[model samples]
Target: MTELRGEALYWEAFERLKSGKAQIIDTNSPSFKFTKDNVAIEAGKKKGFVKQERYPDLCDSIENTENTRCSAASRDPENSDSIKLITSQKKKANARYSKLKAEHDLCLEKMMNLLRENFELRRELQELKKSSMQ
Candidate 1:
């Protein structure tokens, strides 16, 4: 006979219960109590509701802020659009930003190159003047 241990057995039992493959024998059975405790423990861990800090309340506040921002953005007349239009506009804005950044970098590179060339020409001119005077 195969023996399951720890979380493996708990998960197998949970899956069986969820799929109706197994039934609870008694309301107050040890297996039922174990499952209930396991569920509560897993839920608390997943939601970060441990006694260390009030992370769950902080998470709720963060979610509320996100919802508020989404609602405000949707309410804006100038920014309101269907999902497709909004996605397309976002892509266009990103493309424009990228293109501008590339152009700015290219301009900076060309300016640096020009300054280096100018400095080299000035040094050559000074050498020629000194040679001609001698």
Candidate 2:
């Protein structure tokens, strides 16, 4: 048996993967935070994941009617915290994508082995037919 190296193996693997002739294992879904502080607070309360706020007034109270009174409080610091959480979740998603790609490559290698076996069998069958006809 001749050993395939470098570009030849790479192209063979690429063709097998591209032709949908490979099997892949499914991975579990990744954890991600979808909602910001306000949404999380509301969901936690409804789902009993955490204790509800004791005082509703502790939450944001700015309204159009009170805009003049709380104009200086328009800037919220909690938004930055939520943004950081989302950024970290995105990184985790990227890592999971890379893992899936590696699994696909492994599946392609198995497909190449099956393809080689099929080709060898066809060649042997042709040789046997030639010998019988002679």
Candidate 1 residue-wise lDDT, 1-134, digit = tens: 33335334444544453344554333232223223333324333232222214233333433464466568757876555555586898899999999999999999999999999999999999999999999
Query: How far does residue 89 in candidate 2 sit from its true spot (Å)?
Result: 1.5
* Cα RMSD of predicted structure 2: 25.5
Query: Poorest 10 consecutive residues of model 1 by lDDT?
Result: 43-52
Q: Candidate 2 local accuracy as lDDT?
A: 0.45
lDDT of 2 by residue, 39-126 (tens): 2232222222222252232222212213532343236556556657879988999999999999999999999999999999999999
Query: Where does candidate 1 clash, by residue pair?
Result: none
TM-score of each: 0.40, 0.41
RMSD, model 1, all Cα superposed?
A: 17.4
**CA lDDT, every model vs. true structure:** 0.53, 0.45
Indicate the TM-score of model 1: 0.40
As a whole number from 0 to 100, the lDDT of residue 105 in candidate 1 is 100
